[model samples]
Target: MDASVRLHLLKSCISYATHDHVRKSGHRASMPPKALLLTSQPSLRNVVSRAWRAATSITPYQTSCFKPNKNWTLRSIDHGARPYSAKTKPTVSAVLKNIKDHTAENIVSIFHSRSNNPYHNLAIENYLLRNSHAQSKILLFYTNRPCVVIGRNQNPWLECNIAKIQEGLPWNAADWDDGVLDNDRHVIAEERDGYNVSLDLVRRRSGGGTVIHDVGNLNFSFIVPNDKDFTRDKHAELIVRALMAPMTVTRFRDHVLYDNVHVNQRHDIVMTCANVDGGNTQKEFKVSGSAFKLTRGRALHHGTILHSSPNINRQVFVAGDEGGQVAASVFSALLSSPAKPFLEAKGVGSVRSPVHNLFDVTDQVQRREVVRSLRKEIGQLFMDVNGMGDISVEEVGDEDCAVDMNGEIYRDAQELMTDDWRFCQTPTFEYRSEDAGGALKMRFQVKHGLIQNASLEHVELDAEQQLKFAGLEGKKLHEIQSWTSCLPPHAGFRHAKACAHLETVFPKIQPAGAAREGGAESTIIQEADLSGSNQDGIAVKRKAPGGRIELERGGENVVVER
Candidate 1:
């Protein structure tokens, strides 16, 4: 008669029906709707409707039970719910269980991460490497947002343009627009700002050259047992086969040549094509770069596939003999350009090669289609190579997925995001810079991203100035908020010029908010000085708000202004 009493009765009836159904069918019904009888009372009907909906909507794989609080309201108990958060997503344990179940000996498991966070994706890959069954083979595919990923043993400063990476790449709206007829460019413009989209710097637990990742690229990692038969080029060759597969598009069919694509001596996937000038000359372009990580019993071989990177040259073919100069992506060339001459780094350096996007060769192949083709092709190849059958494939990450922040995967991601891992992990290096006027020369010996030694020459310093110069030692290069702050206040014209040179050569790292706010005022210096001598033997010039300064070799003197 009363609401509470009726609620109890309704719950009992549902429970009894559920148990009876399990007894008869050997499986629990998701919700025994048939056991629910129509109730005329308004108060009881609302409770019954809520309980029934909640129970029925639960997935078959999920087990839920109805529980009543003191308020007489019903709540469905979720066994998979994580203690850290109440969101309805798969728990870390559940996901790990799923992975463990599929990863048996002789099994090939394919996991595609939906998260664009490089740290998260890489952490998931690492988990599979360490946690999955040792004998099982794993293929993980993921794409990250714009980020420059350096190898574990590589120097970030030597491998990438840290300033550019910190400032972020420009957002090109047209490049990202899906060609849906109903899409509005204005709405897209409103949604995104066409300014500096800052890229995250990630240091992966792998040993190889640095690489740039953007939405236009796809990353694949293969985790196989560390057996004697394993080779670095094995998976790389599989990628080549996938790339050489016949394209459905007739227009680009001729472009996909088998001999044109193969793994080189460097274990990199490269594509060779005829010069667009109709000459007999051929051009080679690197489409993918490989990196490997080895554990005691497992080996991880991962690489990138440049499909339709917007940062690259839009023109499919260049006009003249200079056609070979086109890079795979602007970011790849600019960001990964050697920071030599200025920085004598100790870690691994990227081998400079002309890179080309696969889209250019295939006439803008769809990224999704490329991923699908690669997955299918690689799955079959893996099975055939391992002499296995019936591989398991599934997508692993999602927006709603519950991530255990305290777990090993989260810790791994956090470690990758730390400043120590990003900067301090860099090998020993020396940075030498001289003012355009030749009045000031500075050399810094950096180890573990800290200035172990600082030398300032060609400039006279007073007691305070000398102290400031000495202070530069033991300071972290990345932690310096402003380069000018490191110089003595009103020390001299020479100091001012040296400050400008240092600022121009090595832009101080700024927070994302500060970078966005002050980016407009930031000076853009040509990278020619950092890379070394200019081929044309021309003067390198830098423009500031006050005046322009030109750097030239020979007897030419630098022109400076107040």
Candidate 2:
């Protein structure tokens, strides 16, 4: 028989078989039977099999009779011929089980996040804290892109220069026109260019002073049982030991470089050096800051290590010897708001201190070597404390794993990224602003991130202007994209200047529409659905800007326009 005629007969046979099976079982058939008839008649089976192969060779079969069923199972046909099975998503219980398995058998479990997303890394830390084995100790290492992370109870306005952070650090030619000079009056090789990376503002769950994280910095977290042995300074001391330990690198083999580094009263790691003239005078600069969180039965301690962050204010530097030039100050101080003197916040305030990078202490040390040294020293300490054998490090946060373990991690990350968590959680504060001559003064009382009261001090206004000013009472501090929008039309120059000052103090919050339309950071979270598969089968495609196609789903408003 001709090939086309054979394929037509095969199709007819498949349709009939599917209709018969559905009529008998009242459900869709997984696969039409080529076995039952083929076993009885071998010649007919061979002909049908040849026809099926010929049809599939041209293009995939897309017949109306072959509908997919969720409950379908793959089974072998005649002569041990098995059909392909589609990939299935991992269940929530299965993901949880995998985590439990990793922690249950191992006394010391180490994880290194491959994700640069701060929210995702933090969420993974939280997940490990809540779900890991109670008796097992967990260590996680992660690095975030350029971002300013404030404590849970801290105020963003007082801790950071919101305008600078939102706008990012742009290169200034004038500042770098002249080469950077060290204490010796010699030019240094430090890059004159400024960092142009996008900065994200985050409010973490742990309570501590605000800190900045970038690619050059490494964050280490410890999740251990909250027992009598657990102290806030334990992990910090371990970190200090790691810094003071001799490097594995050949050039620095016999040298213990960070001997001056020690943990301070506040659990922060600092480096203290004596004056070059052999005097008693000592200079100290913080190299790491620690933060802690205690749950019912578990305790979490996480801290940042400044390796070689280039985001530093070149104006500030520690004096070194005649041949030594040290760049130890971070640009965080420069990015902090100058309005701290005027704003009286209710939450915990950061203790201002001079910071230095580990690289400055020894130019021979690299970020990878720092991480390796820290990991080795910390792992040794953990093993000594727990009397455990050697342990291996596990990596997480890959695309497939992130999709599989998206239940709690996704929710926690989404919550942390929201404006409600970032800004609305701020404590009540009072902002006072005035001109240089004190002729114009404005005071705002903000509670729970909303403006509760507004009064223009030492200024007169009409009834309409007063009403317009009153309109600011219920407005949210973060939602206000522009301070001018809240002011009355043709407001006086003084009022405009005061509003402009307020605008500079407050960070710009991205609108909900912008988030839905795919804004920064949020876009990374929204593009991946909860189930990792489209719940709705309907898809709409449209041509977007830059000649890219945007894919939108019907049931879920997922806009994937990468």
Candidate 3:
């Protein structure tokens, strides 16, 4: 991303947000993913031309999602992020108006997400809010391919598994991943200079910690005007109530580590919560994390409900090893602690990430089928809450609602994807590594995604050598990982090794809090049998430096398993 290149892209990619006053047709070209968008935007002509030439000779990969049917019709059903020709289908407005005409008071809108691209999806979410009137509330059901999304104000480097994200960085496989699931994207990504996956770390315009979404996981968001209570706790409870799950609704507490992760068999989100008692509340863990964004008089309270775990979960580290220990402990505690509607099903896939990111009982295909069933249940729940005994479901192509005539959507998405928003918002913290595992001690200050000050220390380094690491003051962490080739040519081999190692471990962002100080101190429990490990009530705890720093936001804390 060069300055000029990013600018050119921003100027070229149209924003999907459109004004209702300017009514326009909602038809988009069939998504070969890259072909139509590239062809439409002049700047992408060269890239697409080169890509097509290269891709034409390189046989196309048929992605499972893109498996097209020759007999497909405009009325064909689209289950996941697939596209179909809809030229013959009725317009989105025509169908939406039909629903609106029949329904009254608390008019609810439902949409199925068809884009695996988080940027595109997030943009669409905003579009719903930005385009709709205050009279109606919107519910969007979406399943992402594989993407890590963080809150608006949080730091990406602090919240994400940056090391893994960096390893799969430059995902230029648009030509390969086109609506078709062959092994091409995997082959091209893996063999294209040693990257295994093409990844994007997205930031949402809401307040919450990190969340990872994949096809196995189904996400729903609600956008409503501010006519009633808009408190954060109520938002969390609303989701719990709607889903008809027994998981208690809670908030963050003082002296508690704000590991703002969703509490599940595998804790991966951060939130503040506690169970109510006689004027007292039991320590609460997070299952669903809700963040809010107030635009005009309306507020968008969107949250994630963990359904199935994805394989990437094993590689990500929220609080590194400690997060895992806490999740296992909480899950074990919940088994006998009288929490109703436990996700445990004896032999089905459990909700933890590290345990089984992949499907165990069935393949991803079957798992997705389960997700579809879950979506219907969610829809029924939505209707129940809104006092609607009956409601109609509309299935339309995302392109039907997506409008990118001017790339405003791209500009907004580009801003969200920048290094500044991702890492710069991280709270100032110090890192002191121990010699126990070839760790390096360091203190850092990053703002606007740029390193203002950084100092690293290794046992072998002298005072001068210690300061050598300070030469990287102005570099960004994302850029630092790729700087291996640019190490000082004149530096001694030993010095080069240290710098390289420094770069490798530099972004291992740890919590700065020392309160409660260790894993399982906040809560005690066992690794539940949910993950199919079949070992019931195994005590889960571990010791880590900085004691898995606990944070308190408003009132909730997210503790992870070690």
Q: Judged by TM-score, which candidate is best?
A: 1
My TM-score estimates for the predictions, one after another, are: 0.66, 0.65, 0.51
Name the lDDT value of residue 126 in candidate 2.
Answer: 87
- Tens-digit lDDT track for model 1 on 1-562? 2344345446754554444444546433222222222233656655654564454443322322333323212222333422221222432335554556658732676666656667778878888888888888888887776677889988776787766566565544333322100111011111123355566678899988878777667899999898996899999998887776564224345433323688999999988777643656687888899999999799999999876566666332111224354423455444643345577778787777777766544222244455555566666677677777654556555221223322667677667777888788888888876534663666777788787656566446653354356567558877877777786644334766766766655666553212221143536577443344243243445433322233343322222211
Off by over 4 Å in 1: 1-93, 97-101, 173-193, 247-259, 275-280, 314-329, 336-339, 361-365, 398-406, 434-436, 458-468, 489-493, 510-562
Whole-model lDDT, model 1: 0.59
**For candidate 3, what is the TM-score?**
0.51
Residue 348: error of model 3 in Å?
Answer: 34
lDDT of 1 at 353: 78
Ranking by TM-score: 1, 2, 3
> What is the clash count of model 3?
52
Model 2 Cα shift for residue 406 (angstroms): 2.3
Q: Considering summed lDDT, which 10 consecutive residues are worst modelled in model 3?
A: 338-347
Global lDDT of each candidate? 0.59, 0.57, 0.42
Candidate 2 achieves a global lDDT of 0.57
Candidate 3 local Cα displacement, residue 106, angstroms: 8.3
Candidate 1 weakest lDDT stretch, 10 residues: 179-188
| Candidate 2 per-residue C-alpha lDDT over 1-562 given as tens digits, one digit per residue, 9 for 90 to 100 | 2344334334555454444444546432222222111122346655655554444321222111111112111111313211111121222224333776768887577776655567777888888888888887988887775678999899888888765555454323122111111000111111213333235788898999888886557899999999988999998888876676554333344332233789999999997766423566777878899998888799999999886565653433322334354543437543457568679889899988877666532221244455556666676676666787664566554221233345677678778888888888999999776542343466677888788656675447653354346457568888887776776544344656656556656646653112111222322223232222323442333333311222333322222211
